[model samples]
Target: MIHSINNLLYFRQKNPGIRGSGISVNDPVLLPVLSELENLKTSLENYLSDKVEKLKIEISKGQANFPSILHVSILPRNQKVSNGIYVVMCFDILGRGILVGCAESITNPKGLNTVIRKQRGIKLNIDVDGLRPTTKYNNVFENPREFYFGSIDEKQLLDHISLSLDIALYNLGLAKKDDLTIAEKADTGANDQAFDPQNLADARTKIARQITARRGQKSFRDQLLRAYEYKCAVTGCDVVSTLEACHIMPYKGDQTNHIQNGLLLRSDIHILFDLGFLTINYKNKTVILNKEITSSYYGQFKAKKIFLPKKPSDHPHLDALKFHNEHEFKQG
Candidate 1:
């Protein structure tokens, strides 16, 4: 079958203009065989296309051109065929001439020895003039598992290819830089002071010593105003004088100054909450106002979600919520 296909390829190359010469080029027996061969080639090409797409994604992530060569050293070579036959086959398949001028240089004239020694491993000097610059190599050897092809480690080759792409992309200004310099500086200073075991122990003991004395450094009003951008969490009112940083847990109860522990509420709601006229359910992160506040006023505020930051990760701390639910939520 291989010989017949080779003959057809040779004939087609020699007589490129003889498509319809009343010959058996379109013979029914040949037609199905050729169709099947074409289908196989198309399938292989499609499979290669997917592989190329994955490589392209990796390249785009790092701004680099794809590697030029994918060396598969274990390609199959026939030991029985003559150097002339091997050269002819290489030329027909790869569209480039294989040099076999030194075929007689081999001591034991095996076909593989002659071809490998004389022909410089089947050169395919592909013309890149008209082709796009983004082309990737995908040529496959049919019987690659038979010869030296099985010796190369596939995983190692892939890793090397990936590393090459990473380096190329880094060089091409594709990788993102870490922008936490200020945070790093603060961490470094903290680390230096904490490095000594005595200092660390002293700091922990000091924190324990002042556990009860530790009050919220920033007022509820100050913290809430800053947290909500100085706007009412419910009404979106920007009057800084009227805005109060209402604590989820009262100042005396929970002394943490974290923004998540507070909300910027209007004066009326702030007064209601400070007097035990309102509470928040921590589980669903919802507000629950006192029943006596009247439906017209409290209904507008009840079941209405708080205006927290856009990021869910930046949402008020669950620990603060847990404290509120455990101690503050007005149970029916």
Candidate 2:
């Protein structure tokens, strides 16, 4: 449901925007909206908004296949963005293109060339500040498109952008890489840890099997504590008995057994994390608390980065963090 302005539905007209007004997708109605987006761009990189207003915002419209596209690049500021990464938006004055736009991070270095345009995709987040229950799913952008144009709430549209950015980050190996120190991947399938038929003949054998299972659980806990330097990743609760090795992703076969799938949290935090009331935003390197616990002690830890393993190899896999964010982490 991530609606974009440049989606292939509009391709007939030639005029993308008003001329000499700073933007190529020339629509006076969207002036306020663009201003807001500029604010977001500056907030993201900071240096984009220096004391001098000498920032040259190179503006151009899409030609050939994309007639409705308005390509704006903030020049001399974000070399990473203005260089190859550009903000491509569809000016929706005619009711065909979407009001929401995207900041593309394409692989092409030269940018604006015809070849890169043909491939399509690579983007980020931008959110309107006032929209209570605002859309900040992954990478929280301070100011975004919904500041002005259109009727009704555009929070969903902004959320769609954040969601897309989350996916892109996961795919590009830029985020969500968690590696557990002590916990091993669980054998989640029915076949795994299934009692052998021969061993089930006696009650004593069944007891022994149960003991073995407990031992395996202990191993998982031991490894997690070691990975986290024997302290709770959340509260620094060093009480070994109170610490628990918890899985970020739910147990779902051998795939959950990987060490990167686990997190060493205090018992209370582990329970909360499992319940989706608490989570770690690995990209931001901070802890996130759901509304249910926002007023509690856990909330105090909000925006505070958690402790990670010392070794790079021990870092959790990026995919695991992404999974926890999308499917588990509760956010605005």
Candidate 3:
């Protein structure tokens, strides 16, 4: 199948504009099956258009699910396949089947080996909520499985693609100018949440992964917001929507969710803290600003004391603060 695609692309490269008996070179992206699926392509495009519109509407109601993903691609050895795209097949939060395919070009063998931590936003981990036994399609495909969107059921696949133009449009106002050529049957093999939650003994492992990955931080953030009265510690910006709960020690495998380890900050302030432009001296309990921050509003907040919770025990951990100051802060 791959070899055939290579041949077709090679012919098109040399003999351009000759959309002879085979698939149109314009519609180079396909499922590696039948060439006569203009009807299917139109249906998929229409489906995507409707879905994006629906998502745009739902955003106002706060019911939108963002389809951010970690995407990776590889250049096959054939050199003829110009565009490589990974087709991610899985289920959504509702346990209903879903698939997503997006194109990313890898020019050479070295590019294939590079792991793209491109989209840092948390993906809806399919193992936890996606492939559960809510519908009749439960046992049909493997749990936490992925394949090309069209491979499962050709008739129904177009309706279920998760990649929406709305996502790119919303964030970047990005639209593909050309018919995006895609490579199929390529997956990044990244299971951010690894759970084969079939055995009784694996309960600990499953719970541990959940706690380390997502659920713990979510709960911790909520606790911090409530504990600190949902105000930014430095500037007293109380806009709930613009607030973010930031960790004193970096969010990683070793971090703890103790309320003492967090601060409720405005989203921009949180970013500044992460990027080392802002920091707090735990012992002196004073906010410090890097020299790069020339704004009067930010300069006024410099050397100011941060608001602490009423309970002394809920104060920021000195060790976490030390780690941040020593490792994260731009002291120069």
- Winner of 2 and 3 under TM-score: 3
Candidates' TM-scores? 0.31, 0.36, 0.40
Q: How many residue pairs clash in each candidate?
A: 4, 20, 0
Winner on lDDT between 2 and 3 is 2
Q: Please give the RMSD to the true structure for each candidate, in Å.
A: 27.8, 22.9, 18.7
- Tens-digit per-residue lDDT, 269-332, candidate 3: 8998999989999788789888889465688888999988888888899988888998999975
lDDT tens readout by residue for model 1, 1-332: 22333333343344331213222443453454355345433433343363333222101011132112111111112222112111111112121211111111112221211111112244333211111223221121111111112132433323333322322222223322221011122223565654565654564444333322222332434555555776777777775545665666665544455567766778787777666666656666567776676476677778777677555554567887677666665554
Q: Can you tell me which runs of candidate 1 are displaced by over 4 Å?
A: 1-223, 253-255, 294-296, 311-314
| Residue 168 Cα positional deviation in candidate 1, in Å, after optimal superposition | 65
Q: Runs in model 2 with CA error above 4 Å?
A: 1-215
Worst 10 residues of 1 by lDDT: 140-149
